[model samples]
Target chain A: DVKVTQSSRYLVKRTGEKVFLECVQDMDHENMFWYRQDPGLGLRLIYFSYDVKMKEKGDIPEGYSVSREKKERFSLILESASTNQTSMYLCASSAGTSGTQETQYFGPGTRLLVL
Target chain B: AQSVSQHNHHVILSEAASLELGCNYSYGGTVNLFWYVQYPGQHLQLLLKYFSGDPLVKGIKGFEAEFIKSKFSFNLRKPSVQWSDTAEYFCAVNALSNYQLIWGAGTKLIIKP
Candidate 1:
């Protein structure tokens, strides 16, 4: 069984504060993703890392950044937390093998509340 | 713009009831479709996927989905649902580029005993 772990299951931050959400996957997957889940909006991707030090912006990348310094860990950074940023954050990882249907394994989400 | 649509937002049924959820994508090219379920206090997990070959694909927990090319639809179904099957279901499409997925708003299913 693949295990994807997140650093925090719940977090609270004030406006203008910096926040970091960490994720680690044990399946040796090469692709990792960050998404924010909001009601009526669905899961909107924030960023994705296909390899170490490589990152791509997703549909909703404003005010967010990501780090992938190692293969097993991926981090999502909130430059300046705001009340609108309060939502559930999810991290997922895939095998990244080409020509194959890769299923993403998700971590227990972190519900962040920005005050 | 590529988008996935799930018509039913909330559904409630009794146990042993047949279940069917509608999912449609707006894209005219080859695509990969998936159905994901998120139980209470759990992360999203794949219930079924449709890539190619046969339109009907079965997945874990006796769940299945059928892909209709002409209609651009991939609807999920189950012959009988249990109380444990109560969860939120999301339909997603991999189109436009890369591994990025376009997700639907999701349907919350509640089963009564």
Candidate 2:
């Protein structure tokens, strides 16, 4: 069984504060992703890392950045938290050749609120 | 750019009812598809995936999906839905050049017992 763990299940931050959401996978997957899910908006990809220290922007990258210091860890950072940035953040990891759509395991998700 | 669409936003059904959720994608070329389920207060789990070969793929919890290339659709279905089957179903697509996934808005299923 693959386990994807997130640092916090819920978080509340003040406006203009920095927020970091961490995710770790036990499966040693090569590809990791960060997404923010909102009602009616679905899961919008924020960033992805294919390898260590490598990153790619997804559809919505503004106000968000990612860190992949190691294979097992992926962190999403909001430089300055805003009310609009409050959302359900999700982290997922997938391994092996992706051409054939491998299962991307997801963490429990961190629901953040900016006040 | 690839995009996925789920026509059904919220569905309510009685127990033992048949279920089907529609998902459509806009990408003419080769692509991979997947279905995921998120239970209440739980993480998203892989229900089924379609890369190639057989179009009809069975998944956990008696759920299945059919991939229709001509229609550019991957619709999830189940013969008899249980109350436990209630969850938010998301359909996703992956294009060749980009390994990232394009996701649908998702369908929230509610089963009444």
Which residue pairs collide in model 2, if any?
A: none
lDDT tens string, model 2, A1-115? 9999999999999999999999999998999999999998789999999999999998899999999999999999999999999899999999956544778899999999999
- Mind giving the per-residue lDDT tens digits that candidate 1 earns over B32-95? 9999999998889999887889999999999999999999999999999999999999999997
Tell me the whole-model lDDT of each prediction, alpha carbons only.
0.93, 0.92
* A51: Cα error in model 1, Å: 0.3
Model 2 CAPRI quality? medium
TM-score of 2: 0.97
What fnat does each of the candidate structures reach? 0.52, 0.68
- Specify the CAPRI tier of model 1: medium
lDDT of 1 at B3: 90
Q: Model 2, B1-110: lDDT tens per residue? A: 67899999999999999999999999998888999999998899999998889999998889999999999999999999999998999999988667888899999999
lDDT of 1 by residue, A1-115 (tens): 9999999999999999999999999989999999999987789999999999999999999999999999999999999999999999999999998533678889999999999
Candidate 1 at A78: error in angstroms? 0.4
